[model samples]
Target: MPTYQCFDDLQLFFKENNIHPNIRFENMNENSIFSMVKHNLGISIIPEMIIPKGLESIKVIPLELEQTRTIGLAIRTPISPAVKKFTEIAENWCRFDKNIV
Candidate 1:
């Protein structure tokens, strides 16, 4: 997987779990990793939002883990209606994102 803080964390996970992948690739752009998987270059582990299309991959697997990242939206108290609406939409998108995985 391309190097990132998350990859460091994943390395720790693999070490702790005693799992290893024989072949790996590293790059700054996540799309590079995705492209590897998409073009039969390699397999990758990544978040769902990076996917270019829905239900288009050869296989899709979901993981139910003991932990998940928490997401939130914050606004100053006297926010305009438009901002509030935007936050609502964003919050809903967050929920949808979580459910898909």
Candidate 2:
């Protein structure tokens, strides 16, 4: 997993669950992770929306789990119309899905 702040909790969860990979690659960015997966350097669990261009051949497997991520929508005061619409949609979707936000 990437060495992102979001992965901190995930790492702890993995340790508690005794889920360890043979060769783990941490301290990498999302782009590097995607490149590694594309070139068969390693495998990653990424969202479909973030997949880079020209990696259509890669296989996709959706895992169903009861995991939740605390998400936030940061917007400055006096938000634009578009941002307000997006925020509303996002919050509604987050409320609907238990594993997100």
Candidate 3:
């Protein structure tokens, strides 16, 4: 998998599951791991946000652990009224989806 850094969680999963594969850790920022998987180098566990278009070739195997990340909106002071309204609308739109925070 094209990983930016050594993932301890992944290592632990491998140890617990007895999975040993040829591993090559590259600079994480160089490219997304999905790109490496597309090149047929190896497989990886990645967040869903980075998955590219046309994902039919890639098989996404779900992990048992509850992996979650928090996201927030940042606004500079003296924000325009329209911008503030848009932010509130966006937050409501996101909240409409019960699965998303």
Among these predicted structures, which one has the highest TM-score? 1
Relative to the true structure, how large is the alpha-carbon lDDT of every model?
A: 0.66, 0.69, 0.69
Cα-based TM-score, every candidate: 0.63, 0.59, 0.57
- TM-score-better candidate, 2 vs 3: 2
Worst 10 residues of 2 by lDDT: 62-71
Worst 10 residues of 3 by lDDT: 1-10
Q: Please, what are the lDDT tens digits per residue for candidate 3 over residues 1-101?
A: 53543366566667877778677754465355666676887777766656666788778777776565566789998999998998999899778957567
Better structure of 1 and 2 per lDDT: 2
The digit string of per-residue lDDT tens for model 2 on 1-101 reads 66665467666667867888665777457888876776888777554445566767677676465444555678998999999999999989878966454
lDDT of 1 by residue, 12-80 (tens): 666867777774567779767766777888776665555567646535565444324445567898999
TM-score of 1: 0.63
Q: Spell out the clash pairs found in candidate 3.
A: 4-28
RMSD of each: 3.4, 4.0, 4.5
